[model samples]
Target: MSKFKKKAEVKQEIPTSSMPDVVFMLLFFFMVTTEMRKSSIEVKQQIPKAAQLRKLERKTLVANLYIGQPTEAKFGTEEKIQANDAFISTEDIIRWVNEEKSKLAEAEREQLTIAIKGDKDAKRGIIADVETELRKGNARKVLYTAADNSNARKN
Candidate 1:
């Protein structure tokens, strides 16, 4: 009869002491892996398609220049040049380039690159003007951004 009687069983519980550490590790991983652009683009740009494109290795050394028409009606449909968050005139390009260049270390100034992202339908003269300004500013390291054309290669 005594052997037939069963002993009380202890319930096992999960240890949650390491749960917050695991959650924080995941948060830190996402924070470091995700890319967040510092500047907001106000213009609408439909970049031209090209067969070749290269990704910039360091984002901090790159300055983005956007050329396209205003997205809002109040700003008009005329094409404009956007540097960082502001709509800059062609004349401002040189000053903007110099400012961006100055932000980098002297040794890294030569490594700084300007990424020009222009709309497919934007005026060619505008692009030429920007390029001229870049050369004048001695910031000649320029990269033109374009969409990858997958079909072009196949055809």
Candidate 2:
């Protein structure tokens, strides 16, 4: 009998046999769990054109207040304020702001930005009223949105 026995063979390769299955599972998880953040605009939004403008750095912190004429004939031709998807009065703004704040995380609540997007033809008086209500809500951080003068896409 030999003094030393033969050593058993050890495999040095990594197993990637389940890589495709794992990848597909992850892809499917994201596709099903993610919700799109687009808001349907029932009001016409022909945003004003500006000579100089800056873009919002963090869009996640913004709560938009859109001012435009209602598309539906029942709403009349007067400029209307749209928060989220509903038409609301100036008196409703404070409550709306609070609601928007509640939806944010604790750290993000203080950094909330109010974006007022009024159409070019929209009256200034209506916009001013919205601002007043926003102030009552203790929301001072504001942004007036406009489109680039030379942009091909108009919104």
lDDT of each: 0.88, 0.86
lDDT of model 2 at position 123: 89
Per-residue lDDT of candidate 1, residues 47-97 (tens digit): 889876788888889999999998888999999999988999989988898
Candidate 2 worst ten-residue window by lDDT = 1-10
Alpha carbon lDDT at 89, candidate 2: 92
lDDT score, candidate 1, position 155:
44
How many residue pairs clash in each candidate at the backbone level? 0, 0
Give candidate 1 regions above 4 Å deviation: 1-32
lDDT of 2 by residue, 20-113 (tens): 9999999999999987857787778888877567778898889999899998889899989999988999999999999999999988887889
**Pairs that clash in candidate 2:** none
lDDT of 1: 0.88
Model 1 RMSD to the real structure?
A: 5.5
Question: Each prediction's Cα RMSD?
Answer: 5.5, 11.0
